[model samples]
Target: MTGAEAVGSGNLVMGRCVIAGKSACVLYDSKATHSFVSESYVQRLGLPVCELQCDLVVSTPASGLELEVILGMDWLSANRILIVCCEKSLLFPNSEEPELLSSHDVMKELQNGAQCFLIFTHLVVEGEGMICVIPVVQEFEDVK
Candidate 1:
């Protein structure tokens, strides 16, 4: 499934997961044929990429998406993971002790970041004078 379709679908589940020891928002999309990670995210995290034997193209909306990763059916079935949509959770049957990953509205967590970027972009586009962004975390002051 396309990212746009997944975002609009009721079957899609949003949750948090750790990737390379960093927190990341993930979308569990049952309709997607294969799992995918954002190219920009991969570059930022310095994750290795393996070229596919055949070409694969993905089409997504031009804007309004901030997805970092998408876990599709291929990964779910291979990992023996079950999606309990009614309860909004994922069950991992392969684990020594069954593990559950509860789903949450990751959008709520990302709203601040999205808003910040959107405002910054708008100001830049409208030439609304010099803009300064002071991040709460000093370490991330240079992030943008």
Candidate 2:
């Protein structure tokens, strides 16, 4: 699904998975055509990325998604996995013995400081007007 759809649905299946021996937040998005990894997460983990032959464009209507990796249909199809949304589990039909990966609600995990906050502002421009925008970050302590 598009980032906008995922945000609107609010029923995203999220879980913790180990990548390269490091734990990371993983999103199982069935509607997404291809998988993606957050640039910040990759850089932080020093993971190697190979150049793709073709360019891919991603549109996140509302930015600041805190997910570390998104497992899209590409990965799911390759593994012949079935997503049991109601049970919040993944069924691996291709495995010699069917295996299931169950996931718990991620709200508790996110509460432990893995949250991302987005700030939005409105800008007005007149006819044929040009505007320059800069981003500033401020840190605050004891913000409830």
lDDT of 2 by residue, 56-123 (tens): 78764225456888899999999888898897778766347633322333454456664333344666
Q: Stretches of candidate 2 above 4 Å error? A: 1-8, 50-54, 61-64, 97-144
lDDT of each: 0.70, 0.73
Put down candidate 1 lDDT per residue, 25-97, tens digits, no spaces: 7878787888888888798799888888998787543145677888888998998888998977897664476
Error of 2 at 71 (Å): 0.5
What TM-score does structure 2 among the candidates reach? Answer: 0.53
Mark the 10 consecutive residues where model 2 has the least summed lDDT. Answer: 98-107
Candidate maximizing lDDT = 2
The TM-score between candidate 1 and the true structure equals 0.54
Worst-scoring 10-residue span by lDDT in model 1: 114-123
- Candidate RMSDs in order: 21.5, 21.7
Per-residue error for 26 in candidate 2, Å, reads 1.0
